[model samples]
Target chain A: MSEPVVATDMRKLAATQLFALIGFTVREARNKWTLLALFTLTTLFLFALATLVSIDVVEGSIASARLFGTIPLEIGNTTIPVSDAVTVIQVAIVSLLTTFGLVLALFVTGNIVPLTLQTGWVDLLASQPLGRTVLIIGRALGAVAVVAVTFAYLFGGSWSVLTWKTGFGNAGFLVAGMIILFTFLCCYSGMVLVGVLTRNSPISIIAGVGTWFMGLILYPLHTYAEWTTAFDPGWKRSLASGIAETLYWVLPKSLELTENATRATKGDALAWTPFLASMPFAIVCIALACWWFSRQDY
Target chain B: MNVIETRDLAKTFGGALGSKVEALRGVDLQVGAGEAFGLLGPNGAGKTTLVKILLGLVGASDGDATLLGHRAGTPISRLEVGYMPERRHYPGFLTAGQVLDLFGKLLGMDATLRRQRIDLVLEEVEMSSWRNQKVGGFSKGMQQRLALAQALLPDPRVLFLDEPTEGIDPLGRVSIRGILRRNLEQGKTLFVNSHMLGEVELLCDRVAILVKGKIRREGPLSSLRAPNPEYRLTIAGSDEDAARAALAAAGQEAESVPAPPGLTVWRLEVGDRSELNNVLDATRSAGLEIEEVQRVRASLEEVFVQTINEADDDKAGAGGPGGVQTSAKGATEVSVATREVDNV
Candidate 1:
């Protein structure tokens, strides 16, 4: 008597749902005014940077930098090679973006998981012809996309200004955007897990920021703890080694990832230990969140 | 075939300190295709929980259910299912048109198809005039209409509506009822969970009454409330004393029931047809004219209240249900309404 409801193709439905989730979240972010805030702040920062700083290049090898036609740049030399100067600017830009962007972006986007699984919304969402895995993945990626836009705008804008003023392009600087993205995903995965578990936005932010803070603290602690493993007394070495290894393996390597972002400036090889460990941390966090979410009782 | 069916389905929610609240006891139910089935219950009666389980929003603790003959909660089952949740919550940022566009895409509609269906559903929900209006600015009733529109977007085979008219005004309620009736005529299965007995009576062909997670009464609407033994009589005039004296002589008494102009209606119960004849004979001898006679029956609201009161009495005698913590605020006393459900 009733139509089979068009009998949606299973695979096609998943893809459609995924895209719809992204579009839906973007609309939500727009309404929340978070996206506008990101755009505004990024624009002001780029505007100030463009107006205040000027780079003078000679034969693409050496350059003099000045701020607002008044103060001269300081470094190991009055004139540095344009290539080296680009690298320095790249490191500075990546570090600044990751540190400040992490706070603002995660604070704003921390509502993603809980909002996706919101009471009335989830009732309709989970009932759709899509897998639970797809639902959570779509929501996570949707939040990432919102951040991605801001990252591209702010980071790309800074990169453009550096190249335009110095008249030397550093394509490697763009790759550093990849590192920042992974760092965000790692922290966001923790927030997703917390959101799925508790549906608390503030706690979600804390989970993400706390894990990032832990990564910042643990990277150095583990490095030294490894040193103590070779030099400290046997019992102390064993205790320190055990705690450091567990934590280093369990948490995301945000500081180490930042180092890799800096490495991207010089086009250096990434440190595999932190990079590899961080990947699994994000995957595991999100997988656990999805597993729990699928079994959740609304 | 049964479009919606539950076989010994049950759900128990875990509370703090190892306590459990049995939201649904062992329950079996079946609704056929093209059926307008109403799920009736008081607050905290597991009505909402049942809908949630079928949609996979909440996982069932035990047993299983199906939608349109597929395992309930599966993506395949949901493909042909549309649900209107009790709480009408949508992203306030989205316009009504945008909301439909998103939902249409989720249903795998292409850009052109999405556009068409969005327009069609907007018209259906009486939201065409406000398609571009942001949901944040709309009243609750407008939001309710938007929610209903989304559920109808995919032309689903079965619709699960929970309190479909909760925030609507009187005229809007009538319009919604008409839409639901039209859906039924198109042979769509409707599973409605609502407290509005008037609406349920108007829209449902069959119904199940749930109390404390159990289906106490379920059957065709006509069978659920059969013809009563009481009869209403329209007397020629408003002569209460004479009618009472005559009926009292026949060992019966009458209660006044409101009537239109021309005759006064009096209601009285009779044990058999013979007693009815006697009352008529006594009235005639007392010079009172009997203009008309009609059987009296109960309203759905009356039936619902009586069922709830009976369940309460039964629960009191049975010492209440298990796994109920006293501290749980505003929870139902009985965790399980019945282990065995009989439609009869």
Candidate 2:
């Protein structure tokens, strides 16, 4: 029993040190008014969703719906089935929420790394017993934790409202949210790396957005080039295709991750290759960030 | 064992594009346990850089440094060390207590220990009343006090403070000095980097003056400002001629200079204390009564200025771009010897 108590105490101490970064990040975000705004937006969005839609179910199916009881909605009109309509709505909701959530998380949390690198603060932290690598990784995890809490609140509220109105809810939406989070994690790793290297917030955000956009463009182009047997097999075409393929493999697969989340929501067969490939890419970016920060003189 | 030690520690910055700046040129330094050691220098003298290296905030370009017998930049080296940076700012959002708690956690203090230390340190710094106040609303002096509190929260074996009293009021500085004295009494070694000569003189057992990344002079504060082998004597106005003649007759060079009111003053340079006594005997035998005897001693500030100027002169004498290299080489050898003697 004594040994168990000592072990518990040691674990507690380790956790406190490891998660100290989360406390710091949350404190800074509160100071900057970022957390307050995020909470307020989540509340307002929930309120709107709760008030603006009305739904009815008949014979174990969503029978009728109205937009604020004014505009009538219909599904399964002759050729299209109600299940298809549900799939469409789920995909739309996931895409919009994931995309907007990523942007919001990036813009709000972008300054965390640069702020930690500020002269007086960084010096004090570096003087602690904490390793530089732990500091960097802890900070990154802290940012992720903040985003996770915010995403859970937003997505949970949306799920509750939609399930109550339509009598149709899927637990896979939560998994979809996790995938969105993983996608943001990938991009945020780049932001963390850039911020550590430059100690500039705006530049880090721009680099993050640029990385996301490169993935959005390159993944689709790579697919198109691979599938396009219609085009003549010219050297120029082949070179372009090769460059696109290389970029798609090198950069994070933001679009592909989102698509996986959508397919999971639809209960379709999922291809996790892109998701697995991107995980290593994100790890490398964070590792490089820690390396750069460890080598630098504060 | 020395609480802090560095041998041939050198750091250079910004040589990538053809303009190299050497921040520290092979500095050799040692501070014994439970000693208050001062590091003094002008701007760009590498005082802050040296502190940074010792605290493991920065890696040295070359050489070795250790704290509490562990190599610098290792986790173990900093585990028992605390540092208060110049112009330090805690996270503005945190309350003073929260900031201390966070730092305590980073130092791997358990919750119970952290709470006890937070209370003790806050009281030590006279900040117990402001424990819950947001750091953003704090004045520079208050922030400095809080910085001190955090540095002490770990109950560190060694403390490195850079201009700890820079923005504090006079009363605040006195209080801070008192706290530092108390820490020293508790047997904690202190390494202070500052340009405040008076404070250093009052606090440090020994000090080193660094100029252009090289230590120009270093030793006990008392020895750094040794009295000049010269004396000033005052005599009756009527005895001035006799005093001068007696001194010259004794084969000692003497000059009668202007005196205030009705007294005469004679300035004489002597080879030693025995020579000074001989001059007094000669004056007494000539019936020229000596009113007062004065020996001039330099102040720490004066020594600091003179040492910096002498280093500048040496740099100038060596000539051109290579002058810094020559000066650095000579100073490194001297610093090493000083450390060796100090260890003995």
Candidate 3:
């Protein structure tokens, strides 16, 4: 029973404990098959990009693309200009990364909070000298970090591969990766809030996907899908339109974010409305989750 | 100073449809520094709730709980507290050493110090050999030892163990008992929550018997296991008539236990100490030699059962709920306090 004197400061102590919690979350993330599968896919894509795929370049433009050294799909000889096709490829990559990262992250992390708060685990962590808010935030940030690293690997490696072979690259895809991460962050906050409230993983994921759906269906009808004409002209339609518009303002502007991402690929002036509106939703979710986690007992 | 204290502490858990469970109702208790305290109770007796409050796992609905002079659940209060939960679960992927290192970091230990302490605690719990092995593959006993090792990693001033011996073998129990006894010797406090009366009787300097969320009995082991008011004696000679006439002179009678031809053994119910001296005088006056005198004592198990029955509103015969009936929670029939070794 020897007592050791280290004279550690409070800030250092808090930081150390936060790091410890994050480290544990990472360890737990490694155990989850969802993360593992995502990691494996990202690695495989990187391998194929670096090894199997090749592009023939002509005057700083992608002319032909070959997959596993197959007969080149002719783009250099067709009417399609190489630059527009590369822009399409870049946006397609951004969409692929965003859609896959969002769905997989939202699905897997639905239960992450509840799982961390399970009986034995919660009992152990709660008894530690760290605050409740620190515990929750650390785990969430850890999951975010895990996703960030994985997405960065996929996005960065693909950009490098495409640039090496075809002399075509968009740094905007890297920025788009950030946007994807932010989008996932917004969804993650809601997921955590729901999981904390209900302590049910399934319900948490449903609320998360439901939020994404609402953001999609509740966007300005005419601006996104031109759906206002489909409804018969009446007070009922007005009421629906009014409610959907109100809800859309409060919800994440997901579809608009997709458009902004496309704008990013073109190196064009991007709309800030979607990014600005989506931020507050994330802030509110995180604030509410932190408050609830602090007050509630495990 | 008291390292742990609760004053009129109360906790009520909300149940379904507006129902409530009063887990702890006005429990007042204290444990001084460097003391081995045992909180013993049957299942659903609020032992878990009380411990949870002290550890800051749950909020108390009423009253106050303080740890190390800070409000329970505050960061400062748990600075020097070490807790071993009833259910042992560490990240299955982490090695034993890694688990200790992580928990050590939680205590804000530096890498140099954490490494030093982890190695030391691993040796202390005899898990040094398994330091690099994943705990997921360890047996329950090994995991139990590793759990203890983590609790000891910080060298906490107060150690709280819930069923430390649950999955350990008898020899491992002995090993843990020795480790805890040494901790007490080093002027550290040990608070144990267990249903095993024998464990408490062996390890605790003081015990509180909790029943149905109320403390029915609280005191030292010596006072709770009050000795029975009877004595057994082996006399050198066996002459029933001579012994009876001498006993009648002192107004005392003895129940003779048949013995060997050379010795006379009898059991006597003595009203007081002076009466026991008178019986000895009477036996000597009858020219009989006294070989041995023994006093039978009530076991702690018996005390626990009787206290529980008394707390059930004097249902001394009816037994309490959940069949806290006269089974002594699976204990030996009688306990001889003098024979058991005192490790603390």
Candidate 4:
């Protein structure tokens, strides 16, 4: 009887610690709802608004399919030159896409109060019976869930409108949305990695946002400098330059999503090679982020 | 078996330019089951550091400890332990009920059990009315109560409270003491660290006076508090002079100590409590009503002062030990351990 009582007590203790560990994230989400909800809603609203405007343009200019980049392309037996109409729609879509990218960068990199609050919460939680590694992973997953929901609402609302307007229901819209969502996850989760490592909200925000700005501004500088400094380059340097040229694939340029959406909308045969190629770097960054967060002291 | 034990526990901090500051020096403690142990000390005495080590939050420089037969810092040990830290901060966003539940869950309670316990704890803390109120808005006193509630969530077998009543009101302090008493009634061990000697005096079964990271003296309050049987007298007029002359004539040792301007004091040290009344009778019959005569028992405050003074004297003299050695039950074991370590 005594042994059974002790076993029950230990079991109860373990359950309590686990719940407290996970509850840390739930409390954080509720506290910063204003910032999280606003960012999420704003991203969706802009995407939805852009989708509405794009559909209207498509309906208006569906007849002038030649003026837009809706050139004819043959893939096996099917021929679709859905350009002019698609291009008209893609322009507004791409613009919206750019804004989504900016919003993603800002939301992921801005305001670290939530992260600092999270770290303090983790400190309290780590003293319990719960594993430190489990707590860190739980926070990482919680942050990812928040980012996923935000991206879903933004991209889903836009896709719904786009599908409704085109009157051409293609299964590809779902695929394209999934691709964009994955890219956003990669970028935002990387920022969360910064947040997790520093455990300081302000520093996390600065680091995350600073990285975004660097990716945006520095990528162009590197490109221009590559052209100007081509004289000092050898084959290995040229290979390095070539690899760097594909920074959009290796980095979260947001341009890749825009380009993919444009190509998908134009009915151009989309190849999976380039998309798959850019994946290694994204995986590497995500892996590094997880590694750092996992070992981080709660 | 000892509920808690530490062997050769020492913690040294690296100061500026690598100067070594020894915070704790070979502290060996053994607290028995169901004991209310008070760790008394002044500021910078490493009392908190010792508690931190016992809690497994801070590592010792060279020593080891066990809590409930498990290594300190292990889950099994923490399972039976609850701590109310001296410097505490709780997440401000949680409601009083939520705060309780959060800690309850951390102790590994399920939803049904956690809710039930939360309700009970909220009521226990008299915060049931403010159950839905954010802790950020709770007053400092209320926060202290909430901290106590969190510490009590698991109904731990051993409770460690560091200055638990630091920011509490009188009534709040009473409530905390009541809660501790109730827990003690349930046979829980309590290790309390506080500067409030009076509070310790009332609640502690035995106390270890700590100074400069070492246990200066420890024992049951009753033992350390054995009355010194010192009697003081105040006399009027030149009777003080006559009393001194009479004391000399009567072959009784007395000191006519100058106290206030209009009063002088006659002090007589008696060996026992029964001797106090005899001394007073003799003084009165010596043609002196004895303006005021009182036999004072040594308060814990006085004991603390004397213990620290003794430590200081030992430090000053370096080797010539000549002072009262006040140690209670567990202190005997600590002395044995200290000697063992010294021999090794």
lDDT of 2 by residue, A1-298 (tens): 0111111243454466678887777666766576788789889978887877666666556667678778887655434334455556667778886677688789888988988898888988888877788888888888898888888997788778777766667777778888888888999999999999999999999988877878888787877656545556788667767777877897889888888889877877778887888887788899899989999988
What is each candidate's DockQ, to 2 decimals?
A: 0.62, 0.45, 0.55, 0.22
Predicted candidate 4 versus true structure: per-residue lDDT over A182-278, tens digit per residue: 5555555556566665556666656555544445654564547655375456776676666666654556554445466556655566767546754
Q: Please report the candidate that would top DockQ against the real structure.
A: 1
Model 2 pairs whose backbones collide:
none
Chain B TM-score in each of the candidates: 0.81, 0.88, 0.85, 0.80
Per residue, candidate 3 scores C-alpha lDDT tens digits across B1-344 of: 99999999977788789877777767899999998999988776778778878887888889998998889878768778888888757768889998888888888888998889898888988888899999889898888888888878778788899878876788999999988898889888999998877777889989998876777788887878764466777777767777767767878767888888878777777877788898889889888788878775667787877777677664532222322333453343223223322211
For residues B1-344, could you state the per-residue lDDT of candidate 4 as single tens digits?
68889888888776689677777777888899899999987666778778766765566778888888887756567776777777666677878888777676666666787787677766777777888998889898888777777777776778888888876788988988998898898888999998777678768999998777778787888787654556666765555666776555544588777777666677767776456566656656677656676544567777777776777776642221112234453243233311000100
Share of reference contacts kept by candidate 2? 0.58
**Fnat per candidate:** 0.78, 0.58, 0.60, 0.27
List RMSD in Å for every model shown: 5.9, 6.1, 4.0, 9.2
What is the Å distance of residue B110 in model 4 from its true position?
1.0
iRMSD, per candidate, in listed order: 1.7, 6.0, 2.3, 4.7
Quantify all predictions' global Cα lDDT against the true fold.
0.81, 0.79, 0.78, 0.63
Best by TM-score: 2
Model 2 residue-pair collision total: 0
Off by over 4 Å in 1: A1-7, A48-51, A63-77, A226-241, B233-292, B315-344
Cα shift from native, residue A245, model 2 (Å): 2.4
CAPRI verdict (incorrect, acceptable, medium, high) for model 4:
incorrect
